[model samples]
Target: MQSTVNYLWHTDDLLGQGATASVYKARNKKSGELVAVKVFNTASYLRPREVQVREFEVLRKLNHQNIVKLFAVEETGGSRQKVLVMEYCSSGSLLSVLESPENAFGLPEEEFLVVLRCVAHVNALSGPKDSLPPKVSPRHEAVPGQRASSPLSAVAGMNHLRENGIVHRDIKPGNILRLLGEEGQSIYKLTDFGAARELDDDEKFVSVYGTEEYLHPDMYERAVLRKPQQKTFGVTVDLWSIGVTLYHAATGSLPFVPFGGPRRNKEMMYRITTEKPAGAIAGTQKEENGPLEWSYTLPVTCRLSLGLQSQLVPILANILEVEQAKCWGFDQFFAETSDILQRVIVHVFSLSQAVLHHVYIHAHNTIAIFLEAVYEQTRVAPQHQKFLFEGHFWVLEPNLSAQHIAHTTASSPLTLLSTASETPKGLAFKDPAQDIPKFFPKVDLQADYTTAKSVLGAGYQALWLARTLLAGQELMLRGLYWCVETFQATCRRTLEVTRMALLFLSSSLGTERFSSVAGMTEMQELKKVTELRSRLRALAEALSRCSHSITESQTSLSNLRSELLKNRDQVHADRSIQQIQYCLDKMNLIYKQFKKSRMRPGLGYNEEQIHKLDKVNFSRLAKRLLQLFQETCVQKYQTSLVTHGRWMREVHETRNHLRMVGCSVAAYNTEAQGAQESLSKILDQVSHQLLQDRTREAQVSPPLTAPYPSPALTDLVLQMQELCEEMKLLAFDLQDNNRVIEGLSRPPSAPDS
Candidate 1:
């Protein structure tokens, strides 16, 4: 190790070490300013000379807040050692935060946003100069029309890089440094351009070098396969690596791991080239043989809201797309991120207003009724009560503009009354008759008042009604305000969570692997699994919609119950009860749809299915069948599987259909033997022998490969007939469940009946 006083800059402490370089905390000997010195051992280390030169060239051109600034470079010991002094980051690398137990759940959503901005900045800096006009120097001021508050600030930084024709090939959590803003906010900077390179006019690069986990699938293919034609890839490759980095920062884990172990680099590379990354979609089952044992749960410590998760998963998906044409560029990514933030803000604000409107409408009616009762009892005119309420108490504004009453107080009761009289119609107050018809059509107020009096005894009832109305009004307003605040907080949290999840999903599952004859079968299966998973997602969404509808109906029912208790109107209560029952019926239909959709069997067993199979012989049989299928079909037809993609699709569809049939059989018959026999029959019909025979014949004769022979088609058609018969039995069971739901949908029997 070099001494602190060995160079022009005095080294204070060791920061970190990598294969080619070691970074140290240092200060300028003259200026005494803190800095980071990345020292490379050119003679002893592997690729240190090349990396150091590359870093020097790239850093010399880039000068942005997000990209690390190069302060100075020094060479010593006859140029055997090279040191590049750069801006010191006190907050350390993002990897430190991700590794911390304190931040085990990953960085908060806001921090993720900072990271995104940083990525966008790097990408912008790498863009073609002519395509984007020159902005203010990034080191001095932010770009015009760019708000520091906007996450899009990062995009400006990336645009700068793009214009300069630089590609930061190695983008990962470990390479991203964090700086603390004056406000204590995180400011991320993209550092370590060791693998970065400048592209030529052809706009393509052949060199495949980056961290293994962050490498794009195409890059992996280029490097591992060593195909000259496929070696050249575009700048979009950087987006994939950034996506991976973002995901790791968000989820505190890499998206793709080697299937077996860390030593399986070839396997990992092959997987990267040939398949979709594992754990990309939220709430889906990961393959058992998948690289990592991923938690189905999102980070509990950094818990993201459902809304954010929904927005982010798709964004990452788009960026990490395997098809370069389908993948998002800097422009699309910047637009999408901006849209996500804007949409979330708008949605939260809109939702808050809608809730406030609901509360205001209810509160306005309650206050009106309370005022009317007071006027009747005290012989006070309605106008006098309205004036007093608007000025002294609460205003009856349907829009909840009553919140501003404190700021817009009147001089006296007389002045308030005059102001109200002059106020525009429907602004401060509306005709009671008109409002009453809108809220409660054809309802007689007189009858309601009479019933209320009878329920609680006349004199005491008016006092109770007044007290209840006043207390409820205050409570409702307070609750409404609280809900708005809560929603605002949730929305903020959701935005962060979504940003993080997008990064995670993108890194884990975003990139598309190349298709090869060897892994074609797995790819086909992946496609089938993806299709089934989508249906499952649809089922889950339907269930979520149903739950939301039920929640709304329940809230309305609770409010109606409160009214019924206070007013004691049998007719109104009955009518409201019927409406709730109708809601229940609608919910049942949704449930039925969910159930039907849920029958689209996943490639692997879900938690529920796994639990159901526990301690059952069927579980063992299913496992055996799965193993046999993998061996017989997957292994033998692995190469030809690509050629027979349609045949493989049929196989998966038949397998799922068989599983469904088995489930039905197990439900009706306690005898495992019966279910086993059904599975055996289905397996035999779609067995490896049939697939093998077809494959062998195809290899022997090319003409037979075009279409299935009459005998084989006849056998497949007969199997389909058997499948239909089994489905008929399951249909009968479905009908039974539907009949039970129908019975529940009927009107409730009266107590007298």
Candidate 2:
């Protein structure tokens, strides 16, 4: 080993001493280059020659930017140890920089980005693809079955190493070194591969390998701190080391600190392997909401300005997904970073005042919506709306101007936004009625009045529809109030929702998955129950008003019918009994018709089926009335205009009949009435015939005309009676029509139209 060291680096000077080796700062006597030298300790006598040969073989086969470079080994006569020589870096280790603040070792955001890039680049170089010499058993696990490289390179290099039957057992950051190349750039070098091993070798695996802090928890627990090696576990030990390295990089701390003696190592290992990682011990802060909160200072050098901190938290959280399998790997990390950087660059270079102007103009719209919403919540105030519009415009103009500042970045965006919020220029001490001087009085009028009215109408339609369909009347009212306030207050805030939706879509935002079917079921039930309650209240109010109106109309019609009958029965009256009865009937019929028109419909379990049954009954009623009218009155005109008109009028009033075909004049018969005695006999015969013939057809179809004559009732009583009967039939028809309408119409709270 001494001769090999002399061959590698010619000179050596003692620098420090350690348990395993004597370290020195050395220079190549021949080449005048600096290096480090270490001589094997004399006290270690357990197969020293074999260990030295193994170390040389492993180190020589490994080469990486992040790994320390091995030069040579030499042996000298009369010396009890061999010497190992390697390249030396002047800046020392990350450990030294952390321990001493005086090293002037502070990295700004940009510098930090460079560091991360360098680390990523180094990990890419010495990855697991090198074809070198092999040694030991289970080469996939070098240090008792682990890798001897930094955790970052383990997984990437693992499959390649395993394919070639090589394993690194001592994966840790300390063994990783950074070198300066042509441009004074840092490069990584992976060093100290003494514990590497080969697969298919049947030697008993020793547990006394690998750094205690970096060992896999399972391995540590079973190895019992090297007291008695356990014969379990596999190549996943490298994953544990990788986890440890990530932990350190994210939070500048080890998983655990070493303390006590070698026996303490056993306790530490057992704790690591058995206990779960205490998340609270890490530097990531936590709020009551439970999501991890990063400190104000970010570790990476991102292009986002300080003002954009809030915008960046979510991005970071996604990249650092808590789930190990879901976490971003090299490809994902680089891709996402490149995307963000591109956006930043484009924003800086290509952005013009036009963009900011558009944004501010859009903001004006959003503010308008906000104002309308506010008005909806409170009270309608046109003055307030006008004030808000003017104020918003005032605030926006300068903000837009500021956002257009040349070379604007994330840091300046918020600043410009804030500036807009503060000055509000023309709005300060300016009355809305007094149109501000200069800067778009005409444009402002168009945006605030003409455009506002159109936008408000459309926006209100959507908002009200959503509220009425998904919420209740009260909520619908609230939505209206909100729209009005939005239109009035912020003037431009109406566009915020549109912008937010676009941004979220671009961001590829995802929602968390629901955990159970029971949760979904409960949500559905809650919605149904709420809707049911609202419907019940609305139905109750409608029923009450309908009942009262029907009763009042019924009483009024009864009195009027009585008055008509009394007038017809007067002995001194000149009118005939038939004429009087006709007049009274007509009056009664009109009264009944009016009363039926007032009746509203109800809803519930059997409402629909009941409505269908009523339709059939109404057809029967129409037939009976037609029979009575034909027999009682003489038809003058070829068409029964009154009957047809009444039917058409009823059809118009009946919402259910609106879509149905109206009756034609040809469907009604024009026949003269006979004398009273002869008419009675004729009525009986006609009624019988109608029952057997017309009733059947009528039962299956709607009548084309009212079943009463329009002009044959000279006597008020007869007219009133005929009118009453006709009205009764029409009333039934109207009620049935209403029932059908109520049945077909969906509940007010139905989700979709």
Q: Mark the 10 consecutive residues where model 2 has the least summed lDDT.
A: 664-673
Quality of model 2 by C-alpha lDDT: 0.35
Candidate 1 RMSD to the real structure = 38.3
**TM-score of each model, paired residue for residue:** 0.43, 0.35
Per residue, candidate 2 scores C-alpha lDDT tens digits across 144-194 of 333233334433332334343444566665655545678886554545556
* Per-residue accuracy of model 1 over 593-644 as CA lDDT, tens digit each: 3334345443244643432332132223323333433343233223222322
Error of 1 at 87 (Å): 0.6
Clashes of 2: 105
Q: Which stretches of model 2 miss by more than 4 angstroms? A: 1-19, 43-45, 48-51, 102-166, 179-185, 199-206, 222-235, 257-273, 277-753
Residue 159 error, candidate 2, Å: 9.1
How accurate locally is residue 343 in candidate 2, as Cα lDDT from 0 to 100? Answer: 23
